[model samples]
Target chain A: MAAIQGEVSWFCCGTAWGPCGTAGGGACGTCKSGNYQHAWPNTSDACYAITHPDTCGLSMSRRGCGFRHYTTNLCNGARVGTTIADCGPQTDLFCGERTCCGSACGSNRIIDLTPAAFSAIGSLSVGLRPCSVDTV
Target chain B: MPQTLDRRRLLATAALGGVVGATGLGSLAPDAAFAAEAAAIEPGAPDPNFVEGRISKISGHLLLVLGSDTVLHSIRITDGTSIWKLHPTTFDQVAIGDGLYARGVRLPDGTLAADSVWVNIVNLHAHIAAVGRNLLHLDHKGQRIVAHVVQGRSAAVYNGTPAVSDLSLLRVGRHVQVLGAWHPDTNEIDIATVYAAA
Candidate 1:
C-alpha cells in the first residue's frame, strides 16, 4: 500500500465523526460532501467558494477572471479563480524568477512565471507553464 | 466543451494535481513584464446544471435557439416555477427575439422537461442585446434574440471585490453574462450570474 505522508487523510475527519487534529492534520472543520470547512465553527456562513477571495493568498481574486496575482493557479480550472499574488513578493530569495518547484511533478523545480490560483500552505509550488511564455 | 489554449493555464493546473501547493499571486508579478495577455479571463457565471445559451431565431412563439453544438432547437416557452403555480401565467406570454433564459431536465425520451415547463421571461442579457422597450432583442450569428429587461440603478454586486466599481454600463446586445441555477421539477431556470460584456 502507498503509505500517505504524515497526517494526511482524505477522509474528511481522518477519523469517524470526530474533528481532525495534528493526528489527521486536517484544516477543514466539516468533512461532508456538501460541507467544506476547517475545524467546524458555529458560524452559519455557507461554504465559501474554494477559490474565494480570501483563498487567493495574495491580491488575486477568485472572480474567475484571468486575475493573476502570484502568477499561478490551481490544478484544474476548478481552482482557477484563485490568485497567487503573495507568492511574488517572496520570489526574490527562491529564484530571480520563481524557478523552484515545491512538490507535485518532479519534472522541473520553479514557481510558475505567470500568475495562478492555487492554495499554498507554506512553500511555493512549481510546474504550471502558460501556453506560450518566452521563458517556458 | 470550450477548447483551452492550453499553455500557462495547463502548466499551472498540472502543478496543482501533483501537489497541493498553489502559488501566491504576488510572486508572478515579476514575470508580468513579459507574461502574455493573462488578465485572468473571468469564467462564465456559476452554472448549476449548465443549461442556457444565446438565441438565434424567433418566429412568433416558436423560437429557434442555439443549443449544444450550435444546433438550432425549436423551443417552446413558458414561465416561472412557483409552487402555487402563479409564476406560470407570466411565462406563457413569451414572444420572439427575447433574450430568454430557461432550466429543465433531460428526460428518457430525449426531450427536456417535456412533461412540465417553468421559466422566467422577464429579461436577460438586455444590456448586451441592444434591445429597445419593445422587449429585449439582439442578433447573434444571424439570429435574433429578445431578452427580459432587468433594470435597476448600477448596484455594486460582488464581482471580484468591493472596489471593482459601478456596473451601470451593462446594456442590451453587448454580450451579457448570467449565473444561477435550474430546476427540472418545475423546468425552471433562475438567473444568478448576470453581467454584460463588451
Candidate 2:
C-alpha cells in the first residue's frame, strides 16, 4: 500500500483502458482494465454488445400461429427431458403423443403447416401416414 | 472330478470327429441330421468341423448353450470363417434368426474352431416363434430350434429363390422355411432364409 502510481498492471489500465481483444480472432484497442477476450456466437441477427444485450428476440410466439396443440410441448419435452407419451400413438416416424401440425385424411391424420407461417422459422417438412392412431 | 472327466471326454471327442463314442452325447439341437453331420465332419472334408448352435443366453458374443446332453456349453464365434468369394464383409452380419452353416475344425473342448462359417447354409420348413437380431427362434413341430445368420454368410430368400445378398429382408414375426447349419456348442442354427412357410 505504498504510493506507487504508474507501476501496477491495474494502475497502467486506470488510464484510458488498453484496446481489448474481442473473443473473435480480431483485437480491439478500446479495451478497459477489466475487459477480457470474448467472441459473439454469430447465431442471432445482431452482434452482442459489450453489455451482452439479447438483440434476437424469442422465435416462438405465445398465442400466434407458432404455438400448436402439444406440438411444441412434445418436441421440447423430447429434446429437454423424459417424455410420457408412447411415440407409436403419434406415428411410426416420430416419437411422442402429439401429432405434427397438419391435416387429417382417411387412413391418415391431419396435416397442416401452421408453425411454418412464422417469418423467422423454417417450414415444416411434409407429414407422413401415421402407423397408429387412437381408435375412438 | 466330473469336470476333469468331461474335459477328458471332450478331448477324446476331438479325434477327427470319428470318435463315434456316443450317439447322442453332445449337441444342442438334437436332430438326426446332426449325427449325419458329425459323421460327415469326421472324415476328410473341407473344414468339416464348423456348425451352429443356440444361445441359452448372451454375455456379449459369448453365448451359453444347452448343448449336446443339455449341458450349458459356453460358445463364442470369435474369428469366424468366411468365403471371400461369397461375402465381402463379416462384421455384424450374423444374427439369431437367420439360418447358417459352418464348415471348419473342432477344438479339444468340444467347440467348433471354424475356419469357414456359412450363414443360411441349411434349409428347413419350420414355424417361427420369435425373432431377434440374427436369431430366428423357432419351434419345428415339437423341437425348439434357432436359425442364425452368421456375420459373413449370406442368406437365400424364400425356400428355392436363389440366395439373397441383403440381410434387410429378414424379419422376426414371420413363419418361414430356413436352411443352414447347427452348432451344438452355441445351440444356434445358421439361417439362410426366413419367411412365411413351414
Candidate 3:
C-alpha cells in the first residue's frame, strides 16, 4: 500500500462524555481520549464485519491494536501519528460521502481518530476531512 | 499467537520502507510522502455524530460551545454522559474555556445529545528543544509548547517499541510526537506519552 486515501473523522472513548460512555474504550480496550489513537476499519474479523470498508471499494489491511499509522490532513498539510485503538468509521453507512481540503479530497470514511489525534491536524468541528493514512 | 503477532510487527515495520520506498518518491520527507499519497473524496458531507469546541457557557446541563472553526454548538449532557478532564471525571469537573470533543446523537432541534466528552486532550508533533527537571520544551510547528512529565503516568516509546516509563532515553533536539492533556488556553500540556525514534 503506497498510502491509503480516505475521509477522516473523530470519535470519543475511554470513559468520557455521554453516548461515548458505552463505547467501552473500543475493541482493544486501550483507547483513551487523551491518547494519540485512532479507529481502523480492519482491526479484526468482528471489526471488519462492523465497518466493512470493502463494501465501499476501499481495501484496508488488518492492522490490529497498537499498530502505528500516520494520518495526514490533506486540507492543511498537517499530520499526526496514531496507533490502532479500536475499530470504526462504519464505512458502509457513509459509502459515497466525501471530505475535501483545497484541491485534495478523499472519499468514503475509512479512519476515525481520537479527539487528541484529530485536533492535532485540523479542527474537529470540521468533522470530516480528506486524509492519507500510511504505516510509519 | 505470539509468532503471528511477531510476523505482523515485522511486516508493518518492513512496510514502512517497502511500500514507502516503492512510491519512487524516496527523497521526500516522511510527511511529504504521506501527503503525496493524497486522494480526494466526496466533499461537504458533515459528520452528524460528533462536535468539538470550547465551552463558552454552561447553562444547566447544556453546554454552549464555540468550535475551533467558530461554529457554535449546543451540547446536552445527561447522567449517562461520560466526561474526562485529566482522567475519567464528572461533568462538575467541566469549566468554561475548557476544550471539548463530544460524540453522540444529534437532535432534530439542532443540539448534540452528547454521550461522551473529552476535555483539553491534544496530540502534537514537536522537536525536543530542551529538557528540564520534569518538563520537556517542545517546538511544535515553529511554536513552543511546554510539556510536563507526570510520574507513573508519562511514558515513552522508542522507535516503534512498546511504551515504558523512562525519560532517560529522550535526547534534546529529537523529533517526537506527544499525546497529552492540554492545560486549556495555554502553551502547556501534561504529557501522557512521547513517541520518538530510538
DockQ each candidate and list the results.
Answer: 0.02, 0.01, 0.03
Give me candidate 3's TM-score against the actual structure: 0.50
By DockQ, highest first, what's the ranking?
3, 1, 2
Per-residue lDDT over A1-136 for candidate 2, one digit per residue giving the tens place of the 0 to 100 score: 1111000000001111001011111212221111211111121222222112222221211121111121111111110001111001111111121223233212211111111110001111111211111111
Which 10-residue span in candidate 2 chain B carries the lowest summed lDDT?
B35-44
Residue-wise C-alpha lDDT for candidate 1, range B8-83, written one tens digit per residue: 3332333233221223222333223122323333321121211223346655433465542343455433221111
Worst 10 residues of 3 chain B by lDDT: B36-45
Candidate 2 Cα errors over 4 Å, as ranges: A1-136, B1-52, B57-63, B76-80, B83-102, B118-122, B126-198
- Point to the candidate with the largest DockQ: 3
Candidate 1 segments exceeding 4 Å error: A1-136, B1-63, B74-89, B92-95, B98-101, B114-153, B158-198
Give me the displacement of residue A91 in model 1, in angstroms: 18
- Relative to the true structure, candidate 2 reaches a TM of 0.23
Report the number of the highest-lDDT candidate.
3
Best by TM-score: 3
